[model samples]
Target: MAQMTGKQYKESLKKVKPVIYYMGEKVDDITKHPAFIPHINAAALTYDMALAPEFEELCSAKSHLTGERINRFTHIHQNHDDLIKKVKMLRAIGQQTGSCFQRCVGFDGMNATYSVSYDIDKKFGTGYHERFKNFVKMIQTKDLMPSGAMTDPKGDRSLSPSQQKDPDMYVHVIEKRKDGIVVSGAKAHITGAVNSHGHLVMPTTAMREGDKDYAVCFYVPIDAPGVMHIFGRQSNDTRKCDCSMDQGNCEYGCVGGEALIVFDKVFVPNEYVFMCGEWEYAGELVERFATFHRQNYGGCKGGLADVLVGAVYSLALAQGTAKASHVREKLAEMIHLAETIYCCSIACSCQGFAQPAGSFQADPLMANVTKLNVTRNVYEIARLAHDITGGLLATMPSEFDLHDPTVGKWVDKYMKGSSSVPAETRMRLIRLIDAMTCGTALAESMHGAGSPQAQMIMIERRGSLERKKKLAEKLAKIGDQPVLIC
Candidate 1:
């Protein structure tokens, strides 16, 4: 089949029957559910954009496996250009959605697995690489959305998965059958979990020898028996059901529509199991995936920041403050921060090099640096936005009040920003700023790829401080002269 259109993607969901719960009730059809439709719409654009003439070069790629045209999300990073295009594609989608489109996780997972499996095969004489290649071909042909499921529900911070009071705290292989394995545990805060076609499950962290069972990795259909999802709630998510204007980014929603996916003794056939009992390579897979995923923040968040900066500027205009020096300065600061993020993403991509398995990955040090900057810069950008827009962003009345028949006249009269701009237009822009800057959106920016500390650890490991010190010593003539007796 050719790449799916947005409409086809929506229809495809109708055939999937994942066991999903939102609030307290079972969602019969996620495609039709109000809570999921916005996220679904956001993901669908990932497909639709690829078919558009202008975006085709960035959003679509020829599959290395079959030479067929496929969505870039399913294509492996075959070269440095492919890695760079991945960043560009993310930014474009982020600008279009102004929210998490939720496909990058799986894309990163595929690439990480592709390279790591080969190394594992070389050392252990395993056939994981060939099996994974087949899996990639299938995904490319079907153009399916697979949630990259990592991040286990760790019961305690100090304990390893093997030492945890409850062994099931992290996903582990409970029973290894002749045909395959049965995994039992849960993955928390999984993006697009409820809406995706299946999950590419992976270990959350590095593992020791005793943690072999927890190092398991595999793919399972969303509707696979014993797999169930409990949809997570965003700060203003319920507003999605009630009002349009109040919901902010009403059409696209926020933060990837995360969910808690439980695998209760879910059986998987051997064909879908990419890694099993491969404890030694767990850290390699984790690091590779983290670096690739980290490289994306600048692209996606920078694009989102672009929308936010524009909205703030529009708000200033509506209130007749566009020419104010302070507001203009704040706007300029926001643009600078956003562009700085884009530069980091591009730099990392351009510095990317090929792995042993012939897939390109972003430079590790730059990618970590890129994500660390995102953690701090995006917040400052949001702060400047709030300063320019004022407290009215949070204090605004509901959309219902704006449209209420009895008090509507009062709202229109008092809320008017300028004599020329309609009060309704100003209110709409306020709501957009409110949704983009607060609650779930802000938190996702801080910890989406990994926490600030996670990036710091990688930076410390890869920083090459000793080498840098030598350069400094040589420049200062300290290396040329023998060390003093002192």
Candidate 2:
């Protein structure tokens, strides 16, 4: 049980051969597919770092379960330190990739499942806790990249899973057999499905008595019999196929490689199923999973902000505006916003306490607040980056023009920002900025773990307004008496 190197990880994907479709055609080889290569490269960097001696401590951790040096992505958080390290690891990866490396969902999912399963066993006297430990042990031992398939395709926004006109709108158990249960329906916006070795499936929302069949949690291999993965497209994603210069962060592309994972009567054996029909705990499971996932935005996006801030500075220098007081001010603002997020993430992790399970959990209030800020701050960071970079971001000459035989010289001659720097350098940084801010990165920021409204709801629930009101009363000298108006 050793960690896979980047090359080993890439080779491993070649063997998966999940049934994936992109652009109306079956993706035969994702490793070489232009649409998927950037994503693969981005995820591989996670493995690449684990193998680097300099990054080994940050990227690799000794597994509490096996005592082997496992990629931090697979190791469960054991203490407050583990949680802090998780955020730092995410930021580090974000710094390198500048896009979604698409591994955190499973990491969060594993911890959530670990804690919730123990709670389930405590109440129902079930063996799901043991089952989950065995399940995750396999994941860590193999160092697998697993997607947490949580969001379901609710046919109507207003309808719940069981209330939908289409019963298959949300993934649910369709039948029960002696050997296993069969599930159907789909999970949407699944990050890295095509590249993942497996998926950790969980209920999308809280469930009631009527939604028993929908209240299920399990893990399934990506290539399972009836699973079909339809790859998603990003804004200007096609640019990767045609031009490298225009595809800013050309090596990593933009955002998570999301997909619609349709599970049509996929079978899950008893050993693989963690929760079958315990409807009451569905909400608890969802909350646990989301809290950890939300806590993650600070780290990943903060790292990405690092890259964006650097891009802004580089472009300003190339444009001879590096010393402009306003430009420097805006650059500092971007860093401030990004680091503020990191601070919240670290705070939540430091405040984390051990769950009933051995693993620790992030503070939900701070985690939600962190995500809430991320929804706004990412947009603001992008806005400041856009303002400083100028309109050339929107109207840059194509890489083709720069490489053309006749117009190449003319394009270079005119596109040059500062004589001290090359036109190509300016164009490259701007494209990177455009790719990150204008495309999937910002949208993912808004909606990755949950939408802005989702965080607001959690914040309102956890804000403890009553305590604030009591403090306000004490400040107003009301004491224990009720104040009345005439």
Candidate 3:
């Protein structure tokens, strides 16, 4: 097998039988469902773009394991350049889709597991590294999209997994069999879960010896018996199925189509299990995954911000306000914020270093900073966009009203911003702004990869404050005997 084309990718889903439910109805074919199609379209581009000559350099990579050409999404970061290209690739796709393509999660998961498995093997003489490499090869060869399942539905935030009132609140290995193990629980807000080929399940947080059962990582086909996905609702998701103009970015939808994936004692074969009871190493895997994942916010969100900035500018033009001093100033601010995000991603990538397993990772401190900035900067960019676009962005007439014979003329007349620009054109741009700057899109920016607090935690641990203090003391000559200051 080789990298699949977009058409081939869509056709591949027919063979996948993940149990999916949306709006109280069983979804038989996610590729065909209107609600899921936009997201599927967004993901399929990851395949199509890799083959395009214009994007091949960024979207495709030579597999380190097999020396075969593979989608970069499936390739392990073999060097610092590979890490940098990952950010470029994400931005390229984000620019095109103007929404979440939903593949980076698994890409980060593979890289995190690759290095961690090797360390685990070195420490415990386990074969996890080899198993993980084989799994990576399969994904690369077949061009599969696997959701990285990490966040568990913790019933009580204060309690550790082992102390939870319900053991299944966190995904755990309930029974270890000779062949493999049975995992039971749910992964919430799992991006692309309903549309992916399978899931790379990992522990959500660090674990102690008592939490051994919860320190599990493995792969399971989405359609495995006892597995089911409940598709999540977005702010204006219904528009995806009902209206065109109302569904801003109708071709790609807004945000990754997320879902809640449940494992009811799903059985996994030994060949697919990457980690079993390695509780001590769970934190390493989590941090590695978080770093790699956080490193993406600037690339993806920056690209999306590019589109939002364009939308606001277009709206301003349609309203004949493009030359307004305030609008121009706001546009400039949005551009600065978007590029600042891109700079952070690039900086982290440039600072990437090799791991013990011969794989590369982004600079942890900078990567966390990059994501934290995204949590705030993306919102600020959206706020500026709204300031320039006006309240019509939120109060625009529905596409239905524009099409109605009775009210159509009235909407066309009253909605006209500039007589030179079609009311339809203005409406489209406003909708795009509305879709990209509002509810679901903004929330994903704030919390995706990890929340702002999660990034702060990493930043605090990796910030090297003590080292900075030492440097400051040496510079000031105040370490052992303080020097008199002028």
Candidate 4:
């Protein structure tokens, strides 16, 4: 196949079986498991969508190195327009999935590394960039998903990687050999780890020269020796099993259905190692990835917020509250919130700049602003959703109850908000709202890219508060003029 059609991609995942655990049980097959099925389905859509004639331009990109048309996820941002298209494409995927598709982390990580490794070679005379290119080519050719692994166990948040109570708190080099390195540690809260074909692993945070052991980065198959994936729990996740009305987004579980991936004595071939001992550049790599990922949150999640807004508005109509002044005001607030998030992301894309190697980087300040706004807007939108949805969302009987022989009539009668709207329809919408607002959706918003604190730190560090202050001072006739030393 010229492009590894979506069917081929899914078929390829069947070749390597990852050791996945959920709720103390080893999953025999992840693609069939309820917890993972939705994630897989959502990801499959990303691949399938790429082949559609209408979306080809946005979903695919010409490989800069190979001149092949690869999935846009494999593309390195070539210019400001490419950056904008990346954001737009993410929004489109978000609208389709209505949850984190769980692919963008690796997408951003790979692109960031593509550019960073090139720069690294310029200074260090290393061949990392070419190695990365080869890896990308393989992934694109095989149509494999490479989940990006960054965060470590980080046993003690206050301590540096080198000083942690356990040296493995942050993934580090345990054994170095002539052939390759054996790494031991774990990556937590990994999105789509179980469904991915491989991992693009990197240090969770910046490192000092003394922390060289922790500065390693590499890629390996998901089912590589000593790799295991364990699923995390989410609120009301069991609804998927209960077959109840609360099975929010029944086709997909909560945000990305994250898992913790353990790497115990995993040997990474030397060819796969990209950043071994490059401690100083670790920070640059991380910052760049975070910037791109943070921008992504605004695009994808913001588009999801659009769906939420529409869902709530439609819900208001079903409840006969659509014409109410308060309901209209709530809907407007949601629009305002969604647009605020979207605007920040778009603004960042339009202002992208070129890196040393000519790859485009989003405007740091705008990207930070976009993610920061999303962090807050997500909460505000969720709260407004709850307000518009009313209290019955929590107390509603199970879908099974609504379908039960004896209670079905009573449940349907009382649950009716509008005379013409069917009870089942209303319940389905409410369940969807609950799924998006109450469970993983909210936390994903708070976290998906990074946590609220993480966004605020970026806002403080990269945002133009100084520039704003200078503008204010200059406008109000305060502070020294722009002056330079002789």
* Candidate 2 lDDT by residue in tens digits, 1-486: 668888888999888758999999998899988899889999899998988988888898888888888999998889988899999999999999999999899888899999999999999999999988888779878889989999998889887788999999888999999978999999999998888998999998999999999999999998889999999999998898884779987799888899999999899998889888899999999998999998998899999999999999999999999999999999999999999999999999999989878889999999999999999999999999999999998998998999999999999999898999999999999999999999677899999899999889999999989877877886688778355421
- Where model 2 places Cα greater than 4 Å from the true spot, the runs are 479-486
Tell me the spans in candidate 1 whose CA falls farther than 4 Å from its real position: 476-486
TM-score of each: 0.98, 0.97, 0.98, 0.96
In model 4, what is the error at residue 194, expressed in angstroms? 0.4
Which residue runs does candidate 4 get wrong by more than 4 Å? Answer: 243-245, 464-486
Ranking by lDDT: 3, 1, 2, 4
Task: Identify the superior model by TM-score, candidate 2 or candidate 3.
Answer: 3
Candidate 3 lDDT over 359-446, as tens digits, reads 9999999999999999999999989988888899889899899999999999999999999999999989989988898899999988
Clashing pairs in 4: 245-399
Whole-model lDDT, candidate 3? Answer: 0.93
Model 4 clash tally?
Answer: 1
lDDT winner among the candidates? 3
Candidate 4 global lDDT:
0.84
At residue 337, give the lDDT of candidate 4: 87
Error of 2 at 304 (Å): 0.7
